[model samples]
Target: MIVASVPRTWFEEAVVVFFDVVRGTRAEAGQVLLPDGRALPGVRLVEGEHLAPGAVYEAEDEDGRRQDPERLRIVERRAGSDPAVRLEHVLGDEGTVTVVEGALQGIERPVAAQLRGSVRGLGRWGSLRRVHGEARVGLRAWWEAAAGRHVSGTPFEARLEHRLAEATVWAVPRPHGAGRWKVRLELSLRGRSFLRPVAAVALLLFRNRLREAFTDRVDRLAQVWNEIVLDTVSQDKSRLRERILDAAASPPEEPLL
Candidate 1:
C-alpha cells in the first residue's frame, strides 16, 4: 500500500485543476466554470465522476488503453485543521506503479544558487521520486514561477530546474519475515525558460490572469499544430496520388482534329 498527504491550499488546488484541464475532465462550457461568465479555451472536457469505495471506475484515452482509477486518490474533504490530506493506495499483484514526490524540496540545483528561488517555491518536502523497472512512462507538466512569469514563447531567459535528488522502491515477499528487494529511481527536469519582465508586468497588472492565459495558449497552440500538420499531409498525399495516376495512364500517339 502507498500513502501520502498534501496541503489543502490554493496551490494544491491549482495543481489538481491543471491536471483536470489537461486530462479533459473539466471544461469551461460544461463543468469548469470560471469565476466570470466567459468561456475558457483549450481542450474540451468530456466526462468526469468520482468513484465510490468497492465500485470500479475505468477509462481509456486516445490510445485506447484501459485506465484504472484506483491507482490515484484525491482527498476532497477533510475533517480538521491539519491543513494536509493523506493519500493511500494498494499495488495489486499485476499493477504498474508510478509515484511523484519531492515537490517540497524546491526541485533541484544545477550550477549556482540561481535556481534557489524557484526551488524554494515548491516547498521543502523532499527532493526525488521513482519506480522500479516495470513500466514505460511519460511526464508532462506546465509550471510557472512563484514570481508569476511565463515560461515559454517570450524572450526572457531565466531558468528553473525541477530535479529529483533521490528515489527508491522496495518489494516485499509473501512471508512476513521475508527480505525485500529494492532499487533506486532517478528523475530530473530543470532549466525552464521564463519571460521575467513581461511576466512581472503582466502579473502586476493582472494577477492570476497571466497563468490562466498561459494555460489557454499552450492548449490552443497544440491543437492548431495538430490540425495544420494533418491537413498538410492530407493535401500532399492527394496530390501525390493524382500525379502517379496521370503518369501511369497511356496517351494517344496521334492528335485528333
Candidate 2:
C-alpha cells in the first residue's frame, strides 16, 4: 500500500473547484496518459452515486492476465464541517485499500486538502502478506526574499512499507512568478531479504535511468493536471499550455509495459 498527497496549482483558482470538478467527472481507467506518451488501459469507473458515505461504485481493470472487477465504497463523508470524503477500494478476494481527503487545518487561502491512503493484502516477494502506505498534502506560506512577497503552494509527502522494502517520496513546488512553478522531488528506497540485494543491484545498474523515469512521471502528472484545469475551466490558452495538452493526447511511440 502507498499513500501520497499531491498539491497542484491551477491558474490562480480555488483548489476546491478543482477537486469538485474531478470528483464530478466519470473517471476512465487505463486511459491515463503517461509522460512517455504511453497509455495504461483497463480501469474505469463503471458506476458512481453522488459523493457520500455508503455510496457504492463499480470498476473494472485488466490486471495483465485477465479482467478484474472491483467495488468502491464510500466510507465517510463530512460535508458540513471540513467537507471531506473517504473511499475504500474492495478487490473481492484479493484485498482492500482506503483513501481519505479533507481540508487542512489553519490555512485557507490556497484551499489546501490532506490526502491519506492505506492498503491491505499488498506485498512483494510472494508471501501473501500485507503492506501499508500513507501520504499528506497541505498548504504553506513562504516569503520570497527576492520578490519581497508572500506566496503559497502545496507540499506533498508519501511513504510506503512492506516486509521486504520501503519507499518514500516528497515534493515541494516553488512559485517562480508569472504562474510558473518549479518542483523539487526526492525519492528514497530501502529493502531487506534477498529482494533487497536484487533491488540494490538493479539500482546500482539503473540508478540514472530510474531517476529519469521518476522525474518524467512527475513532470507528466503536473502537465496532465494543468491540462485538465485548462480544458475544464479556462478559455484562454497559451502556446506552451496548448502544446502540453496536445502532447498529453498524443499516441504513445511504443506500447506500455
Candidate 3:
C-alpha cells in the first residue's frame, strides 16, 4: 500500500526495517539480495497492452535462473485506469495455483472469525495526540483435505476484512489442490488530514515522528495477527490450531487497536 503522508525520513527507516524483516540486503544498482542468495530486481514499469491476457511468460529467479513458466491473465483492464492481473502457476503432476487481483470483493462467504480493539495515545507533541478509535477484524477460513475428510469445516473460499482505527485489511484464500492454499491480503492505511491547524503544524514540524508513530502502531497490530493466526495456519500444528479456534470464538473485551 502507498502512504503519501509518510515523511522521507520515516519512509527510509521503514524501508530499512522492511528489508531487514525479509532478510534482504541492499545490493549495487538498486537490487536486493535475498536470504537464499537470489537477487530481487528493482521495480520497472511495463506497458499494459504489451502484457496480453492469457499469455504465459517464462519465470526466472533474481539470478536469472530458469524456473517454471507462469501464466498471466488480465482480470480487469480499462483505458486510463489501473489493470487487475491474474497469475497462475502450474505445478506439473501436482495442481494449478491461481491468484486473481480484485477477486476478493466478490466473495460472499460468511465471516468465521472476528476481533475488536481500540487504541489511543498522546505523542511527544501535544498536537500529535491520537484519537481513540475502534478496530474490527473478521476472518473466514476453510480447509479442504487432499483425499480424505475435509477439515476446518469452513467453505473452500474464505474472505476476511479487518477494519482498524487507522487501516483496513482485506484477505481472500484460494485453494490449489494437494492441500495447498494461497491467500491474498491487502492493507490500506487511512490518509492523514492536513487541513486542521494542529495537524498542519505537526506535519510541518514533526512529520517524521508522526509517520513513525503511525507505522509503529500499525505494525504492532499486524504482528499480533501474524502470531495468532497466520503463523498457526502455516505450521499446521494441532495445538496451535486450538489456540486460533479459541481466539476466534472468544473476542477480546479490551480494545486492541
lDDT of each: 0.29, 0.53, 0.36
Number of backbone-clashing residue pairs for each candidate, in the order shown: 6, 4, 4
| lDDT per residue (tens digit) for residues 1-257 in model 3 | 11112122332333333333343333333333344444433221122433345434333443444444332334343321222234433332232333434322112232332222222222343233323222222232332222223345333332332222244445344544443334444544433443345545645787678667766765675566555444434443434333433443342353111
Off by over 4 Å in 3: 1-111, 122-165, 195-257
Model 2 whole-model lDDT (C-alpha atoms)? 0.53
Name the regions of candidate 1 deviating beyond 4 angstroms.
1-59, 63-65, 68-70, 75-83, 89-93, 96-257
Model 1: how far residue 152 lies from native, Å: 34
By TM-score: ranked, best first: 2, 3, 1
Worst ten-residue run, lDDT, model 2?
A: 1-10
Q: State which candidate, 2 or 3, has the greater TM-score.
A: 2
Off by over 4 Å in 2: 1-52, 58-69, 93-111, 122-129, 142-154, 192-202, 236-257
Error of 1 at 150 (Å): 29
Q: Tens-digit lDDT track for model 2 on 1-257?
A: 11122223432334443344334333334244333344434333334544546666554334433334466677777653256667777664544444544444422245345666666654342243456677776544321311233345325778887877889987665555554455567899877666898888888999999888887887788777766644554444334344444554454353211
lDDT (Cα, tens digit) per residue for candidate 1, span 1-257: 11111112323433333333323322333323332322222112233443212222222333334434323333232222222222323233233333321112111211111111211211243232222222111111111211133333221123223342222222111111212111112222222235445544654777566457655764575466556434433344325333333322323232100
Q: Using lDDT as the measure, what is the rank order of every candidate, best first?
A: 2, 3, 1
lDDT of candidate 1 at residue 11, scale 0 to 100: 31
| Model 1 global lDDT (CA atoms, 0 to 1) | 0.29
**Candidate whose TM-score is highest:** 2
> Who is ahead in lDDT, 1 or 3?
3
TM-score per candidate, chains pooled: 0.19, 0.55, 0.25
Worst lDDT run of 10 residues, candidate 3, spans: 1-10
